[model samples]
Target: MNFKGKSLSLKEYNDLADILQNKYGMQFLGDYEALCSNIAAGKEEEKNQAKPEPVIKQGQGDEEKAVFIRGTIRSGQLIRSEGNIVVLGDVNPGAYLEAAGSITVMGKMRGTGHAGTQGDYSTYIAAFRLEPMQLRIGDIVTRPPDGKQYKSKVPEMAFVKKGMIIVEPYLGKR
Candidate 1:
């Protein structure tokens, strides 16, 4: 792309191309000048479109907040929350879930989940079927045993134990 007649470097061009393709659904067709013009046109169209106002509930703060997802997390999708995350459906492979406090899945969890991402190892991950592709707690990262599919009828919880992550049966509240 040209900025006041100055051309962009290859890396900068690639980055801008990625933004255009991913954000505006524009495919690069060997015409940099046309791509830039299309981007400008898209921005103008967006400016003319009406947008809904966001809602904020009173008395709720970030530390006390938890993100709740009601459906399956598909591949290539990522969900991140600053507090906690609770998913009502399965987390499919290639999906990613990250939270600062804890992560809870009401159904199968076959994706990558990172809880306590801010280094709070006390946080845990619980799921009805804890069969994740990978898991990270605090600074520790681990993957499921090689070649073994998880087949459990009960819920399970994973937490930090002795500087490592350990999985155990999630036998409800005491």
Candidate 2:
């Protein structure tokens, strides 16, 4: 399907793909690079159609607030928040998430998550099933060791410890 001149969001694209796959049995054959390019083009078109507005100054209280998102984050999508972020659904591969504060995924996480984007080393990332492609906290970045796999799919949390990222099972009510 040609998406040129169309401004469909990532979720819309995912929904369309699902319908095509399930109903028509046609798989989307585009690569990640092509999908990203299409998304970028749609965003650019949206920016051109919308008028510029003055930057809104956020109060100190807003910095402590959290952003909540519902639904799966598919590939070629990016999510960012100034404060904490909580996703109610899975974060699929090729998706990116960034939060200045902490990040919590209620479902599986199989994408890139960057916490402490504003240099808050104390920020952390938590997920029901942690299988991230890459992770970052503050200025440090890490990935699973080559060929390393977790035996258990338990809920886990990641945080910076002694300048290194550490992942551990989430023990309740610590």
Candidate 3:
């Protein structure tokens, strides 16, 4: 916090890292694995006793890579990640998910999934259950059948074909 001042004490730096780790699942700073190893390898005490260098590096590349999400996309849940999004559990109806790349939901999907919100035409939506009220990719839009959970099967992926969205099973080729 007080980077302008003299070098930061180890306690101060470590406290800051701890705060960031607790506040956010993972700090935007460099990987914590090395730090953990340093502490576990008994070098932490030595490093802490001395003035610790500034952690200059931040998160690595692949910033646009798909984010592997592992949870149920519950109602009122809004998941917006930079790259592709993958959900391990079901996505409730009222929830919303918008990603730059493709979206794959392992569990039931009944929410709104907007792929290519950043304007990529090749983006897609894949879900264990595709029964969304609406879906959009690039400049195309599509709505599922009227009945509740009609022809939509257990595993389906929706993509634009001939300026229209076509939902297909994800089990085999094509």
Candidate 4:
């Protein structure tokens, strides 16, 4: 190809490709010889195929079992459930929790939390100390206000209302 208006030799082209691959984890598709070889060997099709979406199994009936977590969910941890999720401990930053139903954390929630993942907007998220980095309920997404968050003495809950996610103080209701 051309570089700085000069025709680049094969070696220079490959060297540039290697640099790009190493620095950015990107494939350089300009190597015709390699492409032809890969295509002939049927490896190109495998590499180009799109990844399949994940399938979530449904419960036997309309009621699904809730998942209960009993310890601190530290950073980098991910939790997912088909039904509701109840965490008896804290969820630290960089962690994630996703559920098709509601999410209830008895302790602090300072990570990413998603509830109603299956398009059920009626689900909600409740936490004793709700200061999550991000929150999602159904298709709506929200984040903490861009300033210091006030710590509430009472637990807080989030739900979708009027196509927007709203946070409100949760009063225990049997």
Model 1: per-residue Cα lDDT over 1-174, one tens digit each = 323433566577788779989999987655567657767786787788767333222222134558999999999999987778999999999999988878999999999999987778888999999999999998899988887686757899999999999998889655
At residue 18, give the lDDT of candidate 2: 86
The lDDT ranking, best first, is 1, 2, 4, 3
Clashing pairs in 1: none
lDDT of 2 by residue, 3-90 (tens): 4445556687788778988999987765545777867886797799796442222321124456899999999999988777899999
Give one digit per residue, the lDDT tens place, for model 3 in 11-128: 7767767887888766446434655564566565666768754231222212345678787778887898667788998888889888777788888878888887766767789988
Query: How far in Å is the alpha carbon of 59 misplaced in model 1?
Result: 20
RMSD of 3: 13.0
Error of 3 at 40 (Å): 26
Tell me the TM-score of each prediction against the true structure. 0.62, 0.62, 0.59, 0.62
By TM-score, how accurate is candidate 4?
Answer: 0.62
Query: lDDT at 169 for candidate 1?
Result: 88
In model 2, which regions exceed 4 Å deviation? 1-65, 148-152, 172-174
Predictions: Cα RMSD each: 17.1, 15.2, 13.0, 17.7
Model 3 stretches with alpha carbons more than 4 Å out: 1-65
As a TM-score, model 3 comes out at 0.59
TM-score of candidate 1 against the unseen true structure: 0.62
**Prediction 2 global C-alpha lDDT:** 0.82
User: lDDT scores for all predictions?
Assistant: 0.83, 0.82, 0.72, 0.82
How well is each residue in 28-137 modelled by candidate 4, as lDDT tens digits?
66664754464556555556766634454443111345789999999999998877899999999999998988899999999899998888888889999998989998
